[model samples]
Target chain A: MVDQLKPGKSIKDTYVFDLKMSERGMRINRLAEWLNGAENREAFKSDMDAVMDRFELTGEEKKLILDNDWLNLVKAGGNIYNVVRIAAIFDVGLYPLGAQQLGMSYEEFLETRNEKGAT
Target chain B: MAMIVAGIGTSHVPSIGAVVDSGRQNTPEWKPLFDAYEPVRTWLSDERKVDAVIVIYNDHACDFSFSKYPTFAVGAASEYAIADEGFGVRPLPPVKGDLDLSAHICRHLVYEEEFDITICKEMAVEHGLLVPMDLCFPQQGEWPVKVIPVQVNVLQHPIPTALRCFKLGAALRRAVESYDRDVNVAVMGTGGMSHQLHGERFGHLNSDFDNWFLDKIESDPQAICGMTHFDLMEQAGAEAVELIMWLTMRGAMTPDAQRIHRNYYAPMTTGMGLITMQDAA
Candidate 1:
């Protein structure tokens, strides 16, 4: 979970308009470059489908998707940084949560990993 | 004559410059974060008037691997290149290494101090060394001083204890002081304030622990001198507690010294902190 340093309600309670553009901001640019590629675009299309299926998208997010308006996602408070990073990582066949998400035993994952490598 | 100038402790986070390039530093949210380091960069380059720097940092699964990792590795090469780090080379000048001075220090540590450290004749200095150099010695086309990089094995399991690192720094001071050449040496210990970059706890940031760490490093390093790996990992983030490297810098300085520059910022899951102390003598 993202460690929220404060208590009480969320954004509406502590909304600050201070936008932070990171020097490492190129991560998004690079991700966009890949997302434009045929292979990455294909992968992201499926991942987007999975995200839509798994999580409830905000009304604005759904409209951005329906209209194919990429910038609208940012306006929805869904920072492109998160979307591009998660998508890129998924495209690389690497899951951020992995089996750990299910709370599965690491030993079982190790065995499966070894079996996959042997194959 | 031997003259130990000052001690510096700073974070060598891989993403600092990348964060800046991403335009984070320009925003009001992160401008104060970047502004603090401006003085640190100035002090290391302009005021120190340093001829040589002794850098202490650990490699992150680069250079040496888990197969057979040495606790302490000292470079004896005339010149070192920036490490690849599997991603790509960073934009920076080739790091200049002082071969003669490194050799003398190695010999002194081995023979006089009876300390056994792995001698590295051909080793590429990683971003750990490069980041600090970039921040401290910017503006100049190249660094004005030569470098001596001391690689530590803190990534892998069963790494050296905090006390061992402290003693190694003390040994390093003797090695520098014994050098026949008349050169002023500055020691830099690079690592963490409080951050965990890998695994599920990846974005962990502990500013309170980072500030407490900065205070302890200056006033009573002994508080953290002999901490166990488990203890460091417990209080400090797993990836963070590596601040044990600071003990080495503290060990290099005299018992009493005035802390000149100190700053802390937790812009992005990593507590970017820096402290500079003038030698008491």
Candidate 2:
């Protein structure tokens, strides 16, 4: 079905945030969405286990968030937007998360951009 | 009667807002992208005389979370607050909205064109909408013109097709023309040229596809209208499929609208682009 959707070419390394992914990552996304509010963010930061239990996140989902394993999170169906939200809680940003996804050191990723140190 | 003065297409990458807020426009890393907007600011404030802008952007799981995400939403409020997308809220002032114009468009879209959009009484706009405002009209203290935000669902699947977005733009033109006010409205579509922010292809950037898209949007938007969402994702990175929003801006103008200005820059993960068009007199 995914191949049928692509008319001619295929993006090898990208994960499209479609319905199936959304369904699979519903619990993780919900936990991330709750971080939008200040109080919710504070509560999650204070008691990570209780918050994960409250959101009914699976053991694997909790591990993904705890490890800052962004690539695995995406492979486990977490959207990048939501994953970034989760990453922000630990002060990890998009570039660092993306570097981890590409299996490169953050420095190697920066060297690839036109503006290396801008971020 | 109201008139459509101009239509604009821009990329609303969140990092652009950070650069503007930090006062780093002239810096070596950011000069090209920021300098390109100088002419745009002048044209908007002087040449176009746009009294209100219908900003076509998408919500990035900020205001409208996935729990109750609407496919299409229209802001009918008099003012919209800036949302805090994971980070703290931006230091920008609240956006002023033309409630009368918004209500009229809402009514026209539903009854006249049969596009049922969710009407938002209180909506908080994220960088998707505010970044465009900052690029075109840097808020000295107050915004130069009012805005009506039309948010689309580009994140989740079953998003509106390219052709449907084009038809919605046509409907918006009719809605704006039918209004009895003496307003000069500019339709602004903001998002994407080519970049994906997920998986192994986290920083995908396709300048070739983006430049071709810039040309096609001006000369033959119909060519774009026929492309499937998957086709766009494959060629222009997955997240770049948000280019569908640009069709709404193009559809708001005459088929032979004159292209006035065009710019493209791929500084980072996203292919940031800018284009302006005016309806032929």
Candidate 3:
């Protein structure tokens, strides 16, 4: 993660990673919850597993959270703030000022390279 | 005899004051947030013996709108009106302003300071200021100390960069010290403790980053100071990194100062962070 944060790096370096990390979390959480609530739970599991597979997290990030290694969790490249950023990206709260500050739209900031499940 | 007294950095979460005064703290999830302010309350009342507060806060487009925003502005009035924040303005009393001192600050920043700040004679203050005031000076129906407002540009794009905010603080220190009249002042830098409102990242809270930032603010501001707008925008979320304003507050303090009180809570999407440091050193 430190390598991910480099020399002469701007706060944006950390932010884009966090923003992407958060979006992954929200999409995964919603899919999991939706799968659990399904009338046809078994079919939803297959659908959810596919959705989960599309999540941006690598195998390592899931392992870190599962192992509950809070320290290594950050090392794996996300922390409470990272998770919260995902929540904000998925969940909604205060009116965001960054998009306007960055001269971009909210949708523009959320645009992912993978348009498979994009809004 | 103008002297800098204290530097305050906290989240001016709108509706904080009304929530606290109405006993919102008694609610199970909200107590820790408000309880953290008890020390700040005691300090501002007894220790921070600040005669006039030189509020170094930014406007949230509540008073002056996007149609005509000034890079920097100074309030040169005896009292300020609570402008409508889309919702009606809060029922709080009008904030007191020391016209004479404000006039002096305005002149100094324009002439001696060489900073071209808009001298606002009929400016109205919005929640960007009033909420923080309600917390630090809670007992007052009307505020006790006079205020000299220095409004920065944080609402619109191309805001003063983080380094610029810090430099402005140092310049403000020079302005305060050069004032001919005798006055004790405190500079407050409000906003940012890692809460992102808006977009998909609206509820972001960076406690780790927040803690790291607090330490850097005291020991090595250069670490934070050297950061770029892109860095802050990306790492701390575009909105959450406005903590640069804290540099203005930091600029008012001695490089090696004493931190009095610090607290951080995430009750909602935004971080309810608070810190109080003084230059008694």
On DockQ, the candidate that comes out on top is 2
**Distance (Å) between predicted and true CA of B124, model 1?**
1.4
- Stronger candidate by TM-score (1 vs 2): 2
| Better structure of 1 and 2 per lDDT | 2
- State the DockQ, from 0 to 1, for candidate 1: 0.03
- The TM-score of candidate 1's chain A against the true chain A comes to 0.29
How many angstroms is residue B139 displaced in model 1 relative to the true structure, after the best TM-score fit?
Answer: 6.2
lDDT of 2 by residue, B1-281 (tens): 99999999999999889988899888887888888889988897799998999999999998887768888899999999989888888888899999999999999999999999999999999988999999997788888899999999998887888988999999999999999999999999999989888888878888999999999999999999999888898888889999999999999999999999899988778899999999887
Question: Which pairs clash in the backbone of model 2?
Answer: none
lDDT (0 to 1) per candidate: 0.64, 0.90, 0.64
Winner of 2 and 3 under DockQ: 2
lDDT of 1 by residue, A97-116 (tens): 22232244434544433122
Candidate 3 Cα errors over 4 Å, as ranges = A1-119
Best by TM-score: 2
Q: Which stretches of candidate 2 lie over 4 Å from their true place?
A: A1-10
Relative to the true structure, candidate 2 reaches a TM of 0.97
Every model's TM-score: 0.70, 0.97, 0.70
User: Candidate 1's residue-wise lDDT over B66-138, tens digit each?
Assistant: 3355778899988887755544456666778899999998999899877789999887766677777766655
Error of 1 at B99 (Å): 0.7
